[model samples]
Target: MVATEVGDKRVDYIPGNSSIRLVDFPLKDASFRSRRLLQLALATIPWAEKSQYLLFPSIYELEPQAIDVLRQELSIPIYTIGPTIPYLSHNQVVSTNHDYINWLDNQPLGSVLYVSQGSFLSVSSEQIDEIANGLRESGVRFLWVMRGESSNWKNICGDKGFVLPWCDQLKVLMHSAIGGFWSHCGWNSTREGLFCGVPFLTFPIMMDQPLNSKYIVEDWKVGWRVEKEVKETVLIRRDEIARLVRRFMDLDDYEVKEMRKRARELQQVCQSSIASGGSSENNMEEFLGHILHGAKP
Candidate 1:
């Protein structure tokens, strides 16, 4: 979906390149070493042909142009049954002790920011300190989703922000007080953000995150990416983090206003696509019919 320089292959993903990646499925050539896994995948290549079709949780509204390109190139029938979040009953999956909805109630409309890295991908201690301090300095009311307790946050996050081990992210995103998202740009999280019409303050960690960030900032014009220097090592200073956070949180900025407008428009489209008689809903119904009965979709 990113409008980066095109190569001869005419496909977004390069088989061996680390540039296009998912967290767990490290491609054949990545910066990190995993020779054994690569060998195992190579061994399994011949057996992969037995699979019938590739199912994706990607709705057409988000990337109709890209999906059109994919449909023309691929042999298999691809079903875009997505924005799958609404189908999930959070109560059935897990329960939370905290009432974030009440917390959100106290804040002004579109005033707070939500910060989270998904369940996987660990941020270093130093990076955590930087992020916490940056948010603190930004003076923005934020709810940070952290998996475990950390001593560094005790002094850093005062009354300005609330920290939770885990929460129903979709519920939090849907709240009225949420103005922006500081996300790792995981695909699911990306969809949720879009569905809620919240603009992003992207802090991509690894894998598809970079590409997701590219799409958010460049393709969609719904967010800004935090700057980082990558040579022998990746470095993002606390000052830069603070700067980006403050800029994104500034409600008066014209650019930020435009982003919010675009996000809201996209959010409506996404919600409509999953509703009754919507494109994604119809597609999902057809897919199930094809599976459960011998019906053509």
Candidate 2:
């Protein structure tokens, strides 16, 4: 249900599939931003109406409260599917014996961490250096992607890590050597870890990252957040960073194994869903089945 809180509006087009993405909304804030977004969505609603499918990755997105408001107040037909990353991995990423891939191959299983912030977020030189220093001091083998910040972090313990400008993220995570992910907990990355059976060393940045982190650290029991800062001045002590990284890497009990098993099961289910007769497959089919089922366009 959309929040009656916002005066009918649409705000943003969330990324991921057109189908799933509701659990990520910070609803109270979006209500305030809805008016102009309402204008934006209205300008496109006519075009959207002509289209056969109604997909909103995050229903809570773009004043979905308003969309629910409008849908309930009027009668609009919009259908939703779920956490779409699992269903979207038909694309294969091959990581062969490139020097980087080869380097990654040499690390011990459950011994290396994969750290990145996707392409959209950038860390300051200090933060990058701090992390690099931490990883180096931890004596960990890592495949870190620090794109567009060559000068920011190149000098800090360069050889102990493979600091690529970017790498095939999916391929890196799927590697057996990757024990955990040091991530921003973006939905795609969070879901990627879930899919690959790699746990997380979460350093959530903004928006849904914090919420996704909660599921990882608290609900799932598979990950932990690195640090909490009031505004921006948080020192990254090399020892503490190493300690948490070790915690995520440490698979001491049946607990880690159980979580890994669950992740694998979900991965299988997710893979199955995108195939014929699976939930995502069926969901897509049913949506297509109704194209001319006498509903008003």
Candidate 3:
């Protein structure tokens, strides 16, 4: 799938059009955007023009309307064989440190909030400080995966929350204790959260993150956005963060319960999509059959 930022206007690819430009996303430096656009133009233009099929790590169950729209617009077969992480995992067990897993085991189910902004994107130190304080003030049981430069989560949240340099995100999201996620709304994270039935305190930073956030909050009805306006100059206040966290994690709140209900429903849909004879599984088989039979480009 073409991974462009989504917003008020949907970005579309016109087949055979050479003037398609990568849409602008938040927090990118001017020079960086120029270079990235150039790189994408070089890499995707020809590929998009010629590729026979486009495979998205998505399932129609999650976005039937969107998939329907795409099918109508696109000229080629666009397969939705996703929650793709599981198939890609190949059932290879990854070894993880036992300490965090053990800690999660001790906490009550739906008690902990997992916070991570993914590996590549880094926020400003001021924003980081706000997030740390927000987590602390929320008074929620949390596990934050920090980057090497942002190792101060321990100091920020103290012993109230667990701070790790890195851990298996899939493992953490699936843990019984994790009730909510404070995330950048990256597609992988979004899908994982959906798979786990965990609602989000969305803090989208860049690229597809915003689009995924929109889908989570608006389309899916499973999460809430931390900041309405995501800009480099805008810093999310700690109070808003704390408020959103409480709203998402508070099991008693009617809205929170509704979000959880929707998330769990979506989680089941995601699971069923990948199960034997399910939509994604069937699609995968069809995709393979097409390849084996040498479908035309």
Candidate 4:
């Protein structure tokens, strides 16, 4: 779970640690050579040349300790201010006949489930089938948004599962009918879902997803995670998936009551953060001020 970033090295306009960041993807093998090269390059960038830093850190920094480690590691000024989501909240249930909206209204509240595999992280046909069977067995109506070209979903399912390429995820989450999300635990999606008050059925596919999943079920008290990776097979367990879904979706009145409470708190956070005078809102004002004044920071 403690893996590094993926892909080849790329350049970004940070102040420090900005000297040719090498992306040893999956971080599986940092390749001594690549690491040495990175170190050498970093060494070349004069410390005085570095002044400001901007970074989008993981939501794991929601913990105080994680925040401290980042502060320690990056001596130069850096902003670990993220899980930064674009949020929109409404108290009034306005009706716009977006087809999805009508369908959403008709379904039972806290019943129709949502399944979205992030833009990355595709599975095999077998894996898709396993997911389909698991959802079917769980007896939950769902909307599964699958990505990629060769999912090979012949007879895969959309009867009870309204399969779509993509939808307004935030809108879907806010719908009265949506109960739980079956997700790959992408931080952005996770943030939106949390703000919308939907508990998650988390299946972390890669990178910091496992960490994100941990934050949700363990730290945030928002959702449950399915154990990924297997002893014998590469495929996720159909039964395990079903069990997790059922566990997460078991809407006892008390639990639902608490979840609704959680949702409202999250909504408050988003509302204030985006409103004209709130944290992110104010931060944006200062940011533009700097830009207009010419990157003073």
What are the lDDT scores of the predictions, listed in order? 0.74, 0.63, 0.77, 0.63
Candidate 4 wrongly placed segments (more than 4 Å)? 1-51, 55-64, 72-76, 80-85, 89-98, 148-158, 228-234, 253-260, 294-296
Regions of candidate 2 where Cα sits further than 4 Å from its true position: 1-53, 56-97, 151-155, 228-233, 253-255, 292-297
> What TM-score would candidate 1 get against the native?
0.80
Candidate 4, residue 187: the lDDT equals 77
Worst 10 residues of 3 by lDDT: 16-25
Please say which candidate is ahead in TM-score: 3 or 4: 3
Best by lDDT, which number?
3
Worst 10 contiguous positions by lDDT, candidate 2: 15-24
Q: 1-297 in candidate 4: lDDT tens per residue?
A: 122332223445533222222321223224575456556756866752465654443332245455555567666544434447654444433365566666777788788888887886565668877888888777778877776542444246545667667677877887788888888887788878876778777776555565577667755667765654322234676897777676566777576457556756765665566566665556566666676888757
State the lDDT of candidate 3 residue by residue for 237-268, as single tens digits. 88877777876788999999999999999988
Which window of 10 residues has the lowest lDDT sum in candidate 1? 1-10
**Native-to-model Cα distance after best TM-score fit, residue 35 in candidate 4, in Å:** 13
Per-residue alpha-carbon lDDT of candidate 2 for residues 16-58, written as tens digits (9 for 90 to 100): 2132223223332244344455457468968864665566433
> Which ten contiguous residues of candidate 4 have the minimum total lDDT?
16-25
Scored by lDDT, model 2 comes in at 0.63
Better of 2 and 3 by lDDT: 3
Residue pairs clashing, model 2: 3-65, 9-38, 10-37, 10-38, 11-62, 12-62, 20-57, 21-57, 21-58
Every model's TM-score: 0.80, 0.68, 0.83, 0.70
